[model samples]
Target: MIAQRDLARAISAVENGHGSFAQAAATLPETARTAPAYVVGITGPPGAGKSTVVDRLIENFRSAGETVAVIAVDPSSPFTGGAVLGDRVRMQRHAGDRGVFIRSMASREAGGGLAPTAQEAVRLVERAGFDVVLVETVGVGQVELEVVSVADTIVVVTVPALGDGVQTIKAGLTEIADVFVVNMADRPGANRTAVDLTHMVRESGRETPVLQTIASEGQGVDALFAALQSARGGATNAARAVRFEVLRAVRDRAARSALAKLDEPAARAIFASLAAHACTRRQATDALFELFFTGG
Candidate 1:
């Protein structure tokens, strides 16, 4: 059995972009890939009861004889370098379940967006024999759309009374929700919110499916599961290939840009020298620029 500390170290290694980490991630059996696990993303506004919904979802999956892994990203505290990670505590009932592995990640000044490390973490969990992987992000505006980029199915959760539902739909969030869940369906206006969402999605000309759920009591969960299955069935190999090509292109461009910024080693050395000199009142910006550029 891999020790918990070792597992944590492996996750950190992958996060740091080490080649060995990629190799380690790949060694797990192809069975892990073929396993019936689904990578589901649950995201929404800050107070939309997303955590509660996730807790219920995990219970439903586990009861159906599937193992589960959860990666919950929590906002970081700039002053302390620590995170509240309160969502993990709410789902602590699964802590002792042999088939459940739950990990809470500190967003760590990663701008409350999907951390670069999250993809690596998902790879690790997928390889660990879990039949399902659930990722819950630290609710972020706009940039949270990155979740859909990594997940097999993105479930965007929202509530009716918040009055922010329409605005959220107007933003990019509506575009990425493969499954739109009107959580807290027991509240008034839930049906209106659902109808509004259905109409908006139809108007957008996207065929995405929407479902309503009183997630607190497991209401409407079966329909949500059916929608997820339908979406997964449509995930063809051709579509996957296109996504990979796009991601690779983006990565290549980023790499080239980073390399260009550091292309002049001698100029960088001179700038370091000038910076020290300026700190000591030995040079001004204009003088440093002229000397560095003119090689004088």
Candidate 2:
């Protein structure tokens, strides 16, 4: 097994786009892929008690004698391109637990709503011998659905305040959410929200469970833990996740290579003009191909 410090370094290298992650990851035996760690994705809208839910989960997992790693993704500051990483503060009590590792990451302009290196970071942690890996999103809106490609089980946490309607079902959330959590269960309207979610899940022919919880007081957390523990991920989900990761890596590498070959000044000018126009995406693609291939 790789040392914890080495695993941390590998994740850092990948997050920084330093290319060392590939080399470091290659050192692990092929068996690492077969005996993969369970990855759980915790996502919901802002102020939906996602952090609190994750905090409770960390406590529960640790108490059950399981080693856990957390990747809390926070939105990047547009001005400074840095993140406050406040999730770490909420989970600081676990700092002294050798079995639990926590990482704060900034969602740095990745289209998928996760830090581009988040998947690789999870892989690094899993290789370090953690039993469970929890990924917490920035709680942005629907874009958080990207987590479906990275985690084996997805826990979608929402509060009772969001009001029931098709709105809750938007963004393909119903299709991807393995388990739905209505947090702040002690608050009014919690039962209504859970009922609505249950109705929607049943209507869609899925057996997804909607559990109610007051994460702050640890109410109903044990049930949520049981639901997560019992989640059965089929081979199809595993295959899809692996395929998506491979495709993303290939696309990123190709894009980097293309950018490296472009004339910086010319590329900048073209992009600036494109940004000001009402050009469709296909049109922009054609322009890029013309410029890059036809030397226009």
Candidate 3:
């Protein structure tokens, strides 16, 4: 079994872009790389009680004798670049449990509700032999779509009375969800919220399960777990999954590299031209990309 300390280091290496996950993964056998852990993505709008739901799910998985790892993506502090609300703090009950590993990653203002390297972190945790990996994204409304590319199954969480349900529609929550969960079900508007979501899903012409839960109190979590089991696919479409992840990784690195060169001569020249209105923002951006890509 991989030590938590080493696992943490691997995730850090991935997050810092200090080392390649491909290299770290090479040490393992092919089976480990081709077969990934079951990744369950939990995403929703802010204050949808996502973390509490994750806390409840952890208990269920642990009770079932399945090892679980949680990757909680929290918004980063712009000043410090550290996680603002650490989800690990909410799952302290599992701190001493060998079967459970909980990690909190800062989204680094790259919303879509996930840390930049969340995909890499999932693979590393899979290598560590976890039976299930839960990726809890930042509840950044519309941006929550990114998790669809990573999770084997995505549970879109929502609560009662969310600004007339337009927030959910704009987020494309119904389209991407395999399962919909209305958390904080004890609230007065819970049934109405569930009904609204069901109607939306029905319009898509497929029957998607919508379950309700009072997550903070662990009520209805068993039904949620059972729904997840039924909803998740038996096996992922590996090729498509790889394409999404690899392209995103490449794009992320390229964007970071381009930003790092902003103060350099080429980038500065582009900025100066833009400042003087000598070029459209589009042209300046194109020139900057050319300069970065060509090593100008």
* Tens digit per residue, CA lDDT, model 3, 85-122: 66776787887899999888889867677888898889
Show the lowest summed lDDT stretch of 10 residues, model 2.
Answer: 26-35
In candidate 3, the residue pairs with backbone N, CA or C atoms under 3 Å apart (3 or more residues apart, or in different chains) clash, namely none
Candidate 3 lDDT = 0.81
Residue 76 displacement in candidate 1 (angstroms): 1.4
lDDT of each: 0.72, 0.81, 0.81
Assess candidate 2 and give its TM-score to the true structure. 0.79
> Of 1 and 2, which scores higher on lDDT?
2
- Candidate 3: segments with Cα more than 4 A from true spot: 26-35, 165-168, 235-296
**Candidate 1 ranges beyond 4 A from true positions:** 1-6, 16-20, 23-33, 78-80, 164-169, 236-296
Across residues 152-241, which tens digit of lDDT does each residue of candidate 2 receive? 988889888686667666656556788899998988999888988998888878888899999989999999999888884445257657
True-structure RMSD, every candidate = 7.0, 5.0, 4.8
| Cα-based lDDT at residue 213, candidate 1 | 90
- Candidate 2 segments whose C-alpha is farther than 4 A from its true place: 1-3, 26-34, 232-236, 239-296
